[model samples]
Target: MATRKVKRLYRSDVRQARRLLRGHTRKTPVFHTDILGPRGPVPVTLKLEYLQHGGTFKVRGCLNALLQTRGDKTGVVLASAGNAGIAAALASALRGMSCTVVVPESASHTKVAAMWSHGAEVLWHGTTYAEAHKYARQLAAERGAMPLHAYDLPEIVTGAGVVGLEIEEQVRGRPPVLVAVGGGGLVAGVAVALGLRGRVIGVEPEGAPTLHAALAAGHPVDVDVSSVASDALGANRIGDIAMEVAQRYGVRSLLVSDDAIVMAREYLWREFRIVVEPAGATAVAAIQSGAYVPAPGERPVIVLCGANTDLATL
Candidate 1:
């Protein structure tokens, strides 16, 4: 007899993760606004995840992974673009665990510095995240460290899904969520949590359109990754978990140009005094550029995912 496998992230799992992460992570607040939609001024909500610990939502997943580690677990190794590495390193530091983070040469100095500040041994590997990831996997196997993927693993995704649970609790009626997509873990987790209650719209930079390519091909596939937001939003391919959830839940994908992303970042600062990185502002870019138009009388919600950036750049 075939046994039915449990889902990687059930509602109960997400709830438990939220409880476990309560003190470790912040319950980021949502801000409401009226944006000019296709029809007229439409109500909108912004999830200020940039204010989250480690300056990004990645901390939730990292802390969850750290908390779930067994006594026998010795060390952690992972490849990251930036935020995930910083979050993982921070979590490892809090747990007194040894951690190593490998990142592409293209990773931001500000983010790498943050990771180091948290006491993680950091290595600069290849030119792109994909290249760094390959090396990290090999190193982890050789060192016997627990391999951590930024967005692919079930536990990581389940941890990230806690964001969705918080959103539903903060805003009743399950408003459509606009999420910035990199490797797609955040959106996938959100989709799993929200299910039929809300719609998940994934926004990617046009320059690094991994999920866009995957959606067009009807499966995850390699794509050339480059963008102003690439350091934060770059992934060579969409994860299998993300693709499965997207397909099952009908998650829609959208793209915004680098120009739009820059404008959105500036707009956020100018209008709301929010300093967000290019990747963090990608979801807002979709709305500001009309790449994503809200339905009449529909109040959409955008997840402002990260704020890890060189303030000098801002």
Candidate 2:
């Protein structure tokens, strides 16, 4: 019922999004690596999305939306926990447009700096992301600027689906993919990319179970947010498009604890010398913490999605 008015995204839409992206976004690489499993070294693929421009896959969606709305000179206004705002700012700059981002006071100072570096007018609005998002909507209306939703808009999800499309070309088989979920845009885009035959698992932090709660309620619903990964995956509710995709494809949801997220982030650094934010490590956390055990002869792909964090904290 909560998803009734949501627009459905097709695989075709993802393809169109890809076309819109053109030379704007990066085709981030996937590294085939093995993690030490319970039995032995378990093979796993890591989609190194942190290497993407703006240090996250959120740039893909932002570029897609901005490019599609190329003629609009009013610019863009959006709210993000962090990464989405940076993405929107950078993408808007790429399009020769201005960006104004309203971020919660709790947003990462590092990510806020990144947005400023991209020429975004960063404003601190509230204590939480929801409150900032509300103010951003009102601000956008007043300025007649394009309002961007971090994970709700079809362009955002479809642009992210291009990652899946790349995966299909790069990976050998239809291995299961574990993608971190905030408001469900990335996972829904992945589902469209992998199609019916491919398996896509949505991973969330237990402290911020937006998609998990939405799936359980059979509609989008708000949930309280608290997690180390909350800065990136802190959406209070899953978007309607994401909810529709979940129902249409029966996309399963899983939750990982904040401890698992932190450990996984550290593990990637220790083992691979790669750095990611807590939200980026969540998909791997599901495997590391035993939330989703890989099947025999199964090598899952974990999408490491963000790196917009303070190095001093890491």
Candidate 3:
């Protein structure tokens, strides 16, 4: 069988997106802390992507894809579990384009409202992300609108790779990066940016291990999804581009329980006054639960990627 030609997102691609998004996106700084460095005196750096425009790292990819592909009067369509929908809506609004977002019934109400607030025509579809994705594609086809993928598209992942570039330049010691995986876009992009220089740990909720299952199967495979983080980290299957990047770069996948996720979220609030959604707390959950322990002297960097949560619940 002939091997499929996978278009890789190189470091140059990431740099290009970073340059393009300079004036539009926020350059979130690293917050150094000793809270998770409990194993010893090692420092822990948190890349506060939750402070980004549209309140998540999803904005980076959404904006980049729209910026690169949008034409005058171009309409866009996308399916998201939650955060990606809001990002797409915000990106479209910024670019002065019309957007329609199809979201799963399981999506958070706050996220759906945010998408609507950004001038997107929001539609409720199936109960899972995969189902919504199928309907979204059909809607795009019917309406002759440009279809935007939540994670699989090269432009999106390439934009996400910019986060890794920022992390490398912003952090003092170029520490290992720990990121939560949903459809695996963020980790794959980070893998491309960091390459072999630093370890990229891909964290996931125990209830929804899409990347983990894919890595175990040696390919992208559908998995059952259910967890506190499902609204954000609930892709039925890992994206092909993401799997290729992860395997090529030797990105490590780790899983943490939902309880650990709650604990991590609470810890962030207690220590840093940071309010993060469940998916945003997955990386910290791995450390807090010892799922991915830092070495004696290794400095681990965690990317808190979203804040579009119902703060009242927290």
Candidate with maximal TM-score: 2
Sort the predicted structures by TM-score, highest score first. 2, 3, 1
TM-score of 1: 0.95
| Count of steric clashes across candidates, in order | 0, 0, 0
Q: Tens digit of lDDT per residue, candidate 3, span 1-314?
A: 00245797788888899888889889888898766633544467899999998898989998999888845548899999889999999999998889999998888999999998999999999998999999999999999898999998888998888899989888866578999999988998888888877689899998889889888888888899989999999998888899988888888899999999999998899888999999999999888777877777777999999999998878
Ranking 1 against 2 by TM-score, winner? 2
Tell me the spans in candidate 3 whose CA falls farther than 4 Å from its real position.
1-4, 36-42, 70-73
Q: Residues 1-314, candidate 2, lDDT per residue (tens digit)?
A: 55569877888999999988878888889899887644567789999989999999999998998877855566899999899999999998988889999999999899999999999999999998899999999999999899999998989999999999988888888899999999888999999877788789999999999888987888888899989998999899988888888778778999998988888888899999899999899999888888888988888989999998888777
Query: Model 2 scores what on Cα lDDT?
Result: 0.89
How many clashing residue pairs, candidate 3? Answer: 0
Candidate 3 structure lDDT: 0.88
TM-score of 3: 0.96
Q: Which digits, one per residue and each the tens of the lDDT, describe model 1 over residues 1-314?
A: 00123255556777788888888888899999965434546578999999998998888888888888876777899999899999899888888889999999888999999999999999999998999999999999999898888988777787888889989989978679999999988998888888766799999999888778888898888889879998888898888888878877889999999999998898888878899999999998888888888777778889999999998887
Top candidate, metric lDDT = 2
